[model samples]
Target: MRLHVDERHERVLALVRARGSLRVADLAEELGVSAVTLRRDVEALATQGRLRRVHGSVVWPGAAAGAAPDTAAAPAEVRDAEGVVAGMVVPTLDHPFGEIVEGARDALEARGGRLVLGLSGHAEGDAEQAGRLVAAGADGLLLTCDRAPGPDSGGWVPGTGVPAVLVERAAPPGSPGADLDHVRCDAAHGAATAVRHLASLGHHSVALVLREAADADHLRAGYAAAVEALELTPAPGSPYLAPARLPEAERIERTAEHLRALAEEHGVRAVLLHGDEFAVVLVPRLRALGVLVPEDLAIVVHGDQVASLADPPLTAIAPPERAVGEAAVALLLERIAEDRRGDRGPRRHVDLLPSLRVRASCGAVLRAAGRA
Candidate 1:
């Protein structure tokens, strides 16, 4: 679900009507406003008796005290799309994903739609949380699917009547079947740009380092395609050796050794890594191994999570993560509006391109190769 305070209040009222009531935390998250701000809005509604604050949740006039069951708001009217309530589910509120959530909030606010947000930290829990949000009165949904749906899961956001948009997830049972509205980064294009950047700097063979659990099939495919285009060999056996969870210091050291082995064995001169967090951890480990970044082994990172704040200010493939969220909200809202209007046109699938952010970590690879 999605915010600005003035931008969100109307939508809030709409969701209260649809759902009968809501929690301060969920309302805060979806509206992209602080809890304090949302509380004030709720308080005003309560004063007017349009809503009643009960414990941590809000209950509308028609709902039973402190309840949000379907029958709780029998008198609530299904308003027009301008005041629709949408639910949003995401994996994290950290770094990159946080931007996506905020973007959805902003976009939804602009359309006079309110958002309800849920966090599904893992794939196994996504279905349940999505179900909860739908039951909680989300007219439409926007979600990010990190893994394939379980047998019980069906369609986007897995609800009966809700329109949904999938973020960074493709459709059609894996055969280019974009069955729903979606917004994703052009991973293939981003990977190619990474490879080309290193190649232009004279690094013929580069490697990728990632977490095994990360959804990197697209990244791997793009890397392979880029390497083939440049006629260079890729690091063997896939470089996804990092643990799914946070890396311990010892684990970082071991990964550094592994990278060294790959560099020597495969002649990998530069590496494109996952996020700034990994880059920060790896840089120190590499320095301990007497490998100077760029001078010894050029480095680039994928996401913009504290890249500029890193020690050497690592370069990154800055994708429009936030814009992807905004796009998802925009798409979901369009679908909802159309559904309300009885317009069943073809769904839209969108992919936004990312660009290389050249910084000290990777620019030296170019200078070494004498390209810059």
Candidate 2:
């Protein structure tokens, strides 16, 4: 028989109370519920102060320090953290964010500090979440949002009285968040590197295909700069391939067809594609259209997430996601210390460059001798 929501929650609480803590995966399996459903239940329980979430596990609210079985064996410094409590707010625990959060957690634990998470689905609720985190005794904050908050938007970080650092997001000039410290991946450099890599593999004429996103402009800038510097022949038409209105399947199919046409018409020997998932789907679609990868056209993807899983294992630009998180925490800790000592310093903006992961999709071996 299916359990009611209340009954399921009660059972979850009882199990956690008995076990001191439970891995989310293990708890989900024991309850015979999907991880998604269990996560929702856990979030609800956490909000109600009935339980606490630490990375991948849940702990009983009243449990003592190190009571959680998973963390009981941690080093003394981590187990006996009485340092600053750092609150982190991110849009979601998806893709790159998961690695970022893990890096932050590890850094904080090593420094005898604790990490608390706040999930604000978008920029609008970021301030509210930060406020709640501060009220719960957070000494500093680390924030990531989908976009930079506007000047008149009653900025979240600015309003949060504690020291805070922005992770993988930048503040616009003269904006409310402009004075805050931030760390981000230099997407422009990543895009430029992809173009240069293709050029180095003897692809004189390369095309750039992009999905409209927060970082698209930066990627475009890098591609353009590299193309100009190298004087490579540009592919026909715009780089943006994703149309907002079309269904996802149709969008991928259309994008593939468009790229094929570009390759055939402009003699485009290589292409830089943004978004890993899109590249994965597009490659198969291109194959079905009689366009072979690395033979007819070589491809390099922007994001590394799942790119290695693609057929032929795509070459990709991997952003320094974990480093961004670690750096953000380090910067925030500095800010907090400065605040404590009544010292002020100039705002800092850190930009980390992404690296290229070469694989089968770029056909580098075949064209190595032809490099310019």
Candidate 3:
């Protein structure tokens, strides 16, 4: 073969040069590749004699110092195959999921694909929209089903003979004959992080504000595990399920008031919101109720942007939303190509890990220390 390096190899080399040094984890995070993928690329590049791979970082060949490295172009396919095909259905484009949908669409477009999106106003209406999108010849389906009304909610995978990928939620238990590929963030990790964060801040009692009843048992189990891991008891007599009805603005306000009352009764010092809209509505309402954020009480909102900048800003657990979208698309394409090959792809799930992006609205550590 001619002496040449692949695009991935070039990227690893470039990042090493730019950062002077990098741990594999950091490189993988920055380049949007898996650590396994990064390692292979680095090994290949090292073999090419273009870079020297150390424990975690790579170095320029014969370079005296490890700074001021030149930039290398990312592969055209990697850059381009970032968008979805047109007319793909993206259910529930609100707040956190909406951000995911937009990112997924852009990613597909980058890859010369199109996304034909649809919205389901209510859980009862999801099946109809899903069918409609499939009938309209959507190349693939990208669904955000975490907020779906129940675990047995139907129509997510219409019998369109097209590949279906569930974004941000695992495949619901015990109800599927269809080959549905799943790509979801590590919600358990995020939830556990929230619990530990609150506990570390001296909050003994806290509540998780959820939107709809969880049809997925995994979520319920995860919640229990998190509570136990944090060495805190679940709110006494608190319901383990999500709300049964879709919450209106007035209802959300009422819920906040109810939560504050419950917090007071249970001696809860903090609240970690599982639902984005709930967090958005609760912040101002909590302030109105004279429950100062991170002062008289603390809050850690789960999900993304909606929470991060709500009014006073929120301390939140942010999943790798864009990365999840990217992975989902990648999975779909693999399945689609296999379909063309008369080969059904193997059934599998992709679970992306989450990270914390701390911000203002939670508590000022200084405030807690002062109180202490």
Every candidate's lDDT = 0.72, 0.83, 0.64
Best by TM-score, which number?
2
State model 1's lDDT: 0.72
Candidate 1 structure, TM-score to reference: 0.72
Among all windows of 10 consecutive residues in model 2, the one with the lowest summed lDDT is 73-82
Query: Which of the predicted structures, 2 or 3, would earn the higher TM-score when compared with the native?
Result: 2
Question: In candidate 1, what are the lDDT values of residues 181-226, reduced to their tens digit?
Answer: 7788887788878888889888878888776533466677787899
**Clash count, candidate 3:** 25
The TM-score of predicted model 2 comes to: 0.76
Q: Which prediction has more favorable lDDT, 1 or 3?
A: 1
Report the C-alpha lDDT of model 3 over 1-372, residue by residue, as the tens digit: 222337666677777666555556567777777788878777877797877664345556764332211212432333333233534445466555766776675456544566777776555354566677777766667766545434454344647657778777654555562346778787877777877787777777667666553323433455567788777877764433345464576666666676677666667777777766567776777788877776666877767767765766778778787778767766776666666567774777788877776766667555656789
Model 1 spans > 4 angstroms off:
1-81, 122-124, 148-153, 156-159, 172-178, 245-247, 264-266, 364-372
User: Residue 190 of model 2: what lDDT?
Assistant: 96
State which candidate, 2 or 3, has the greater lDDT: 2
Clashes of each: 7, 0, 25
